[model samples]
Target chain A: MRADMIPLAFRDPVHDSQSAFRRLLRALSRPGTPVSLPGPAEAPEPMGGPLAAIALTLADADCPIWLDPALSTERVRRYLHFHTNAPQLADPRAAAIALIGDAGWLPGLNGFHPGDAPYPDRSTTLILQLPALTGGSTVRLSGPGIETTTSLAPLGLPNWFWPAWHENAARYPLGVDIFLTDDRAVVGLPRSTNVEVP
Target chain B: MGIDLAFDDHGVYSFAYLDEMTKRMIRRAILKAVAVPGYQVPFGSREMPLPPGWGTGGLQVTASLLGREDMLKVIDQGADDTTNAISIRRFFARVAGVATTERTGEATVIQTRHRIPERALTEDQIIVFQQPQPEPLRRFIPHEVVARKLHAFAQYGVMYVRLYEDISRLGHVAMSSDYPVIVNGRYLASPSPIPKFDNPKLHRSRALALFGAGRERRIHAIPPFTDVKSLDFVDHPFTVQHFESCCSLCGAQDSYLDEILLDDGGRRAFVCSDTAYCAEQRGERTKS
Candidate 1:
């Protein structure tokens, strides 16, 4: 697709980003709960509305973002660069935020930065665009944000995802946080949450 | 020196005072803070009109979160009409043009210093705390490097030792405010300077709690339904302050109270520290 065909960014930058951030906050603060996200009306192929909205809301000139192979298309990169001005890094470990188009082809979680002992906040925040928020194998989540055990069944994840997530949670304050998104909604699974797969 | 026309203009400040970039930076920090639950995320703290010891941190957090639709409420020591509370409220009103309210229930975002409102906050509401010091280990270990390492390893045995020392000295925990708590069974966090009575409210709260310390250049958070356990010994459990005397005017036994000197003849009266709660109680009494 031509550069001209790339979709426009948020109509109202200030209010739209604020609204999107609030929704993201709500989703992350309540693990496994799917929350509606306000994204641009249209997005490039493979990239959905919620993913684009999150990218626009978070990515900026100061933030370094890494795009997965599936989402490394010219149209998507041009769209993100035109709007956010965030530098696309070659290494996922160095990027502050990583965008993954296909969850089934997720590169192992160990490759990404798990931050350090002192500054755990330096870790990357992965935004994975999945097929859907639900209708898959279920997993139980408990910890911060959850009053009791809550379950999530986001579709399109690999069979090894839950085991890898358990390993991620074991790192405690050092693991990368995740935001699972479909076309219109998002669900956060922070490192603090314990994901149990039966 | 001649004043520039742009500087002299009344509405020169951007919406909610901070620039969009700054807001974005702070917002990112806030998200990380929420994800970590209690771990402090350092940010670029900007200079506000208010002094550092005041509510500048809380002001910045509130400013970052504020929108045209939000209803803001500012309080100092549980009173909405106090000088600090009123000034901050008016500041937001002038800068952001958002509606300000004294009622806790009506507020979407509540900026507070040293107190959580007596009324319970709902799921939709958020509480921004003005934290003088965000690190709970600061008192125990003055060295920042060592404290960071201790936090990294989840080594909180020092804090328990301190509490034990207090118990040995005073026969009970002598801390009156600014108590240390374990957030989500992970990092140790300082819940601002709210009294022991308000400490229990932090546990599994329905509303999100965001803490900001401007001078400290740190931001932290406690998400809704998260565990916040105050430090204490197993045999001598943690307890809130109890008042033998209820409010003098509203007669509320459950609310935190403040003592007022009625005269120089050693006479004093106790009243509810939360002025809004006191007024509401009085209104209910009058109706009945």
Candidate 2:
């Protein structure tokens, strides 16, 4: 931690961003379970509380972060660009990292590359901030990382997300990975993780 | 309600960038590479802030695929201590917060420019090459159109013509830097800009081969047994260069020699091309 160059407008919340990030990985490798982050940050601009956490957790110069029209602002752009060198792209497909906290404008999750059968992991990871995401949904999650069963709040993806993702998983090797971030948490849904979605 | 005096100040070092999504992209590429084994996939490349020819491409692959518990090795011109090598090694240590190592055997992901390590790699290891141009036909003719056709149909006649031209005109292939090779019979690719001395090392390796060109926006892979063929005329055949000198730093014979200039008298100093390789070999001899 470089104590000298702390940005004045940055989030000083005492949450372990790194630990949350580590948890993000486990969630990604394991799928569907919620992992909490410090979050609830004052996201640069246009973005809300939950979105702030996603940007703080994933933004970097190396990754391409596509900010939707629903959450665009000069302050947000400058902050992300200055901090993480993460270039903002016009198209979501070109993005290495896609940040969509607004449930309404988020693209159909299946529109991005799901991956190829031989190389099924080529899909884009959609980081979606769910609408009131708290557990108690009947969705049964099972797959590569999950042993028996798990459940969580309805991941606020597009209505078309499940059908598209099911087709995606059927292809195997080629598929997208997903991260569902709620108030202060995030979880993964890799293609390998089978979803009953009942 | 309590009055608050604190203002928001974002501190340094946020969570890592290569998120599960991005990591999934690279991992999927790797899994496909494992499945078909050696076919290269043309992926949509992201624009990293760094310029091309820099280690940005390799860094992307390294960042995306690295797990929390992985040791990374970065090498340039075969030496792990080269300034560029050090820069990349430090990059991962800072960003991904992963471990770095000079020892080849300990590293799970070895990001390299030019030559592969003198020590053999294992199945667990992956070598990512920083490629300036991923297309094999760049040298023969700079036409992407024709090159694409050549690669699409496995028509590598032009490469042979160039090699035969070298053998006939100079008695040896006079090309060095970004040598072309046929990977998996169908795809002809460049092995980054490594000198031709490292060409033979690509044969029958246990480790995976991934090539990325950030400027060109492409990523591809070569799996084991993929049959990487360096374009050669049957008559002239393929050849690798060897320096007939010992390393002054760690005196070992039969190693790739990097030319260094000594005093004003114009004397030359020859040392191991692989810096860590030289140190390891010498350390072994001293211990024995």
Candidate 3:
């Protein structure tokens, strides 16, 4: 009962996790589509609700996760470790799942796994913490998910992130997929999404 | 003696007959499959209670994606009443406790073997296909390692040669079902033995199409509004099968028909392969 009050993890692990995974799945399938995430993960400072919810839902013993140094506080590490039991990797490239704690200090795409041509799926999925999902510069996206083109304004990303993402998309079957999460919402930007600034 | 109801109880097996971790793994693979849009993503295919060849891949995918609210549908060669479809549908009904439907329009997730439904699917709907063989280059390159390399380099010369040979020998490409389609103009994928007639449904489809090969241990996906091109040369363009006469039962000239032998002698009759679609058409006809 005390544990329930703390709310460090999902209240109903089975159902909550399933719901979260399904949301993540839908978001990934339809790129640039924002899906409301499950809340109340009792997240640490700077690690918003949605990312914490995602961490609890997807990460496990098998998938090694990497947290950006800025957000790698002892409390955040403890919370993730106690909840997910996923190994934390120091090197971003080695990580299957990478978390961008501060969008201002975003890393280059080369550091992470741009998986080989044959096994492009081996690349990492970046879970970036953004300021807000709406009200940012609208980036036009078109690809498998979008019927023609869709616009999403995800705030708190670096200026060069869009160009880097375009370069990443040019790689096609070899770029990393991403999840942009704010305090509440999460949107997926798959490698297949064709991003344009205008 | 009363049949032991204990085995049929809710807690006897995990929800949907698969552990959460396994489902998560499959889910991750599905995400990757959708992202790449038709590239084969290798997954740790788990053994189901059913036989290996019997829709295990589709079952695993369905089990992973399925939720309590999802309305499910299962079909084999477009028929909702086949043993394969019925067994799968019933399995989900028992384990997942989700609603099952025969009508294509009502289903949120339609797991199928060798056929896409006759009706057009909505954007929200997802189709999971039971793929016996996910790779299209296997016919030319038997070795898996070599085939992987060939796909990596985009060295599809052998596939073109094979098609060239078919045109030279047979007048036209002889492949009826399981036709190879270059997905998003990238990887060559098997369309799960669905007839060439249904291949057009795959191109820029409104619904998401997922292919699972349990035995082969591969999963692929074609996301909604994606381009899927069937392989054909300029001289011999891809063409679908058409019947001379309409369906003998429902008179559906446009629908894919199943030819049944009336007798050992030469009499044959054609009817709609999709039982539910045929029934729905009949119901509409009677209503009018």
Candidate 4:
């Protein structure tokens, strides 16, 4: 926990969060892109590395957040409470944002609301903290949001996720947005974009 | 209990829960909503402490719009004290500390469930709906693949067929809750779960309406006085329902009512669906 909170420095927190946050906006605005955020901050354990940094970037009093119960602890909750006033959600489907350290046990993306064509932008954003964030071996990506057939070498993703994401993207404007974070950085692949696994 | 000031470090979490970047993204979405007028925009939703099917999305929009001078009102199915509504009201009182009201006339913003307030809402007021499912096509096809294409191209045959199917089966469209509507003749939007009975209130409404689905990560809007139509065929047509009984609790004839049972005798009673509106009307009568 101590390692995860070292970056909440008031003197430099705003400055550091600025660059990372700008990129998150860019990533969401245009999906299926890997934009690495600079992070040396200590993220709460389980959240690990860049994902934790992203948590700091997005958590706020405005958005309600939910996390896998296994990753939640008194200290971590306390830190998050102090950092982001975001209420803890009991149901993952109701949260505006969620953090999933392990994707194996997560529910399907379809349970989420995909906004209609007249209002097609309703969906959830999931941050899956994986063991590694590589774009080479585990999966290959190609779609509207990616530059040129990008690859996501994710570590330890459940077998069901790839096909599920394919189904999610099939919804076009209405699907879950994703962010995969590991020991070093974070990469996003929104449902508007497509993915392929090798 | 000692409050910790150490976590206020700027480097960790920014002043607001969302980094300026996330807020900017939301701000951009808001601008688009304004531009399109009655369109729902897909956004990246964050997790809140509350559940999804509840008012988390409305709370998010309320949180985003709140400041030092805002008065917030939250109601469920139009009732002020329904457990979930009370919970959300208490949530804002704790987190944002904005002023709260049970009077629709006094509130700057109202977060609501199924029904709109019985009292006419003003132009300055913004009503936010806690949407369980923002996608109108979701139940029709149950296939994301089919729903998206239909929506993108405005191929809403499934919805028409479903409504027609209801008319064929129930004689009057067996729909009672969360009726879907097309806003401004272009954007197909959900009116949340507010029964078709409330459909007339959507057309030319004075208030600015916003819809948010927390779990779905989507947000949409309706500018003041916009044209909103529930999808229906010309020959079949569409209509709203009004309870024949006045409230057994409040005794108001024009207001929406809720049906409550008394005991094992199957005895039931009707009450105002909008508790605050009921109380306010009673107050007006007493004063008169």
Candidate 5:
């Protein structure tokens, strides 16, 4: 794709970043609940609105971001680099934030850093691109933020994802937290949540 | 003359005071706090307009979290009109231009010090607690390095032993306020300075409770429906303060009251600590 073809960043950087950050906060606090992104961001080809908004809001010069093989294209790289100014990391394990564009071809959950017990806050935050936020296999989630049991149907997740998620949840205070993004909405699945998929 | 504390110098402060990057960092830390439930997430807490130990922690959080649409409510010791509350409310109104409210129900975000509202909160509400001390085991273990090691292993035996020692010496657990509670059966966390009477409300509540200790540079949270158990011995049991008389102003037997002395002659009067809640109850009673 041409360099000029890439869309510009948020119209109002301050308000836009603040709004998107709050939405992401609420999404992660209440797991599996989709929160709307600020008015659609100008995204490069293959990069959706939610992911673009998140990249603009969160990724900074201090944080190093990694992308899955499919999303490591020059266009996406240029877009993120130009917008967020975040360094691109080749090693998945070293990523502070990992953008997984293709969930079906995930290279296993163990590849990423889960942080140490003493400093569990250093864990990787996975931004997984999904087909849809709803209308798929329903998974019952129970944990912090969940009152009783809440059901979420995030579409296009791989068969091996749930088992991997169970192992991740078992890590407790040390595991990668995930954000599942569709076109314009994102839902969080924190490591504390116990997932039961049928 | 006292230092001119007025911010009327017309210096262009950023929206909400903190920059976008700092807000994003705090926002990320808050998410992590909620994820871990009780584990404190360290952040680069910034110096605010006010001095330390003066609700700066809560102010930072309120600043980061405030939006144009949010209705903010600030209270100190459950009173909305106190100096701390008024100053914080005024600061936000000037900085973020958010609407300020005294009614607990009307507020979307409530920044508090030393007390939880007497009125129950719903899911839409978020309570930001100004924490002077974030560490629960700081009293038993002064060194933070040692405390971190103990927390990593979940070695809370010393905390229980302290409670046991309190029973041995003081007949009952003498600690009244700043009661420690176990969050999600994981890390033992300080629920700020809210009275033990308000501890039960922390367990599986509908509202999201966020704690910020700016001086300590730590932030933690208790998400809605999270399990929060007050630390107690099976035999000793956790108990809240009880009074023989109801609130003199609102006739609230069920509310938390602050005892006041009328004069040196020992004339005593009790009133609800949550002034707004008390006024609301009085209004309702008059209407009925």
Candidate 6:
């Protein structure tokens, strides 16, 4: 595809990105709660609107992103490159943000950077694109953001996902944080959250 | 939608005073900080017009988070009319053209130094704290390398020993302000220099709390409803300051008070440290 054929980013960059970031922040702060990203409806194949909005808001030249095989298409690459100018890295460990199009083939959570002891902020933030936000296996989540306990049943995750998430939570301050997104909404699963599979 | 490449009409400064890249950097750090509650995330701290130690950290964080629709409120030592508070409020208003509020409930974002507002904050509101020091273990262990290792291992004996030493030397825990707390039952964090009276407010707060230390180049956070336990011995539980006297102006007994010296003859009056809360109380009394 030609460079000009790539879809455009936010029309009002300053205000739009700020709004998107605020929504993302709200989603992350309140773990297990789904928040909607209202802007930028257009995206490449396999990349949902919410995920695209998140990428436009956060990914920049400074941040290195890794795309899973399903999302590693030439069209998506050109779109992200045209908008964010963020480098796409082959190594998932080196990526600050990893876009996962297919959850079934996702590697172990330990394969990615859990971050160093002193600086856990250096860890990767995984943005997984799911078919829908809910109606799957139920899991109880409790941690910093949760007042009591909240239940989430994100659809389209692999059978090994929850167990791998348990291992990720075990690392505490050293594990990668995750954002589960559908086409319209996102739910955050921070490292501090404890997931109990019932 | 085609990208609008037009420059922002908000005068010489960018939308919120900080450049887009800088805001993105701080925003990323803030997200990491929130993900790992109480853990300090180092970022490229920018050079604000205001000097260091004067709420520069909080200013940057607020700048990054502020939108045109946001209602900003700034307080210094809980007073809304103070020099620092007024200056910051004015700065944002000029740069971002956002609305400014003195009422705690009316504001969406509240930037504070040394105190949390007396009024309770809701889930919609966010609190930005100005931190001079982000590290709770800095005083106990001067070496950064050793402190990092200790945090990595979750060995917080030094902090407990410090409290023990305080109990041994004095009859009670001597720390009046900036008491250390364990966030999410993991990392030990400094709750800025807020008085012990305000320390309890940090526990399971409904509002998201973000702390920024400019000179230290660190940002940390405590998400809403997070576990923030103040350090204490099992036998001797944690306690807050008690005030026998109420606010002279509004007669608010539950609120934190500031002792004001009226004259050189040693006449003192206790008033609410939170000016807005006191004023609101006075207004309510008049209405009733």
Q: What is candidate 3's lDDT per residue for B25-111, written digit by digit as tens?
A: 888888889889878999999999899899999999999888888999998988988899989998998888888999888899999
Which ten residues in a row are the worst by lDDT in model 1 chain B? B279-288
> For candidate 3, what is the total of clashing residue pairs?
1
Please write out the lDDT profile of model 1 over residues A1-198, one tens digit for every residue. 455776888898888888898899889899899999967866798998999999998999989999998999998999999989999999999999999999766758987999888999999999999999999899999988888999999899988788999999998888999999998899998898998887
lDDT of 3 by residue, A112-168 (tens): 998888789899989998889999899999988788899999888888899999999
Task: Name the candidate that leads on DockQ.
Answer: 6
Please state the error at residue B106 of candidate 3 in Å: 0.9
Off by over 4 Å in 5: A1-6, B1-11, B284-288
User: Against the true two-chain complex, what DockQ does each candidate achieve?
Assistant: 0.77, 0.04, 0.74, 0.04, 0.75, 0.83
Docking quality level of the chain pair in candidate 2: incorrect
- C-alpha displacement of A86 in model 6, angstroms? 1.2
lDDT of candidate 4 over B123-159, digit per residue (tens): 6677888888888877767886676566678777778
Provide the global lDDT of candidate 3 against the true structure.
0.87
Taking the tens digit of each residue's C-alpha lDDT, what string does model 4 give over A1-198? 444453352234554554465455444423444567666354455667566666666667766778876567665676667766678887776776778877766766665555555345444568787777654356666543233565557677776778888887775555667777776667767554567766
Model 4: share of real contacts kept: 0.05
CA deviation > 4 Å runs, candidate 2: A1-198, B1-15, B33-40, B140-145, B284-288
lDDT for each of the candidates? 0.91, 0.65, 0.87, 0.68, 0.88, 0.91
Model 1 chain A lowest lDDT segment of ten: A1-10
In model 3, state the lDDT of residue A111: 83
Q: What is the interface RMSD of candidate 3, in Å?
A: 1.1
lDDT of 5: 0.88
Over B88-206, each residue of candidate 6 has an lDDT whose tens digit, in order, gives 99899888989998899889999999999999999999999999999999997889889888988899999999999889888689999999999989999999999999999999999
- Pairs clashing in candidate 1? none
Q: 3 or 5: which has the higher lDDT?
A: 5
Lowest-lDDT window of 10 residues in candidate 3 chain A? A1-10
Q: Candidate 6 residues A92-112, lDDT tens each?
A: 999999999888768678768
Clashes per prediction?
0, 15, 1, 41, 0, 0
